[model samples]
Target: MSPLNWGVDSAAIADEELLSCVKNNYGMPDFWGRYLSTVPGASEGLTTNEINFLKSNGIKIMPIYNNFRNTVGKQQGIVAARNAIYRAKRLGIKDGTVLFANIERFFEVDANWLIGWVETMFSSTYRPGYYHDPVQGNFNEAYCQAVAQSELVKNQSILWSAEPQTGVSSKTKIPRFRPQKPDCYATVWAWQYGRNSTECPIDTVLADQKLYNLMY
Candidate 1:
């Protein structure tokens, strides 16, 4: 694992200037978040040029499946996950890719619902992952509990938490990757230390490149 360093992850892909800013102002990002949804800005989605650029620049992509609607039940989870797979495939992302299911803070995570999404996606083209807050213990949360109690969450399913660092400098800075203890899952792959803050150009996280390579 590498030390916590500056990185950016956004639905808005960086232009040349932004990428320059990233390299000059911060540093080369370890990973990035690319939207695989039909959102307004992300509707155009990813391109071969972008993938080539990132790969050539040594940045790994973290594909996001953004279902703007609530996925609170088993049926909804299945539907949303399936749709995410469809969009990913349409974007030329192959099967076995690891996709982070975006669970917004407004959505209440239910045990059965989360499991449904993970299982459906896992059985299909993409490997399943969750981008959510893990309160209390990591695996103790409802989402983790659901996965822990079932066979849906396999060893490959990655967990990315959105827990911001505390007592950091007021000045813009990249927090270190210090995962909380007793996570529901055995390991946490990434931690979002900055969320649309001045700390960086976009939301950012600290992750282990080796773990991230499993999906890519």
Candidate 2:
């Protein structure tokens, strides 16, 4: 089995609170998967201070660009990616960072459009990853199909499967959600087992021995 690591992701965490807790508190997450923008526009990306604090603290940052509710077609893919990259750059998220395209549950992602978005990021100096539920949702499997059917997409994508209500290491032995390969990526880079509000909370995952160097 591939070695598992623990981390936390949040869409609503404040900058000051995150910095204070991560610095003073004995426990804090190894990595942060923060939301860059909610839609395909120059929306609320992270602030300069927040970006610097996380970087200065040696935190591994994974950016999530979500436009699930918006109608994103193949023609609009370039526009969406451009806006996302612009927001990321403004917030100090440098190029070459792996940014996951948020494929929210219940929303159907167009194969060509998804591929276009991934390719756009690749050309712009950023890596592409997919964030979605592995088994329970249709989007996960749909994206898997998209990648498998497209030679272009298969080479440019990474997977971040979201199977909440569990953890990287669960003593309870509950079944974990793992995305099917080829349909999903061959390897899962990250798995969101649970949220900071429930299951294995941020403090618990941050304390895991396997993730010690994640925060540097």
Best by lDDT: 1
| lDDT tens readout by residue for model 2, 163-213 | 544533332332343533334454455666544543322322221222222
| After superposition, candidate 1 runs with Cα above 4 Å error | 1-6, 41-44, 136-140, 154-156, 166-175, 181-183
Instruction: State residue 15's C-alpha deviation in candidate 1, in Å.
Output: 2.1
Task: Encode model 1's per-residue lDDT on 1-216: one tens digit a residue.
Answer: 654434567766655776776666566776667777647744336566777787788877778888556756788888888888887787677667788887766667677777788788878867888777666333336665675777666455677777655432222465556755224554577777666645445666777665566444
Q: Pick the candidate with the highest TM-score.
A: 1
TM-score of 1: 0.81
Give the Cα lDDT of each candidate: 0.67, 0.59
Listed per candidate, the RMSD to the true structure in angstroms reads 3.8, 5.2
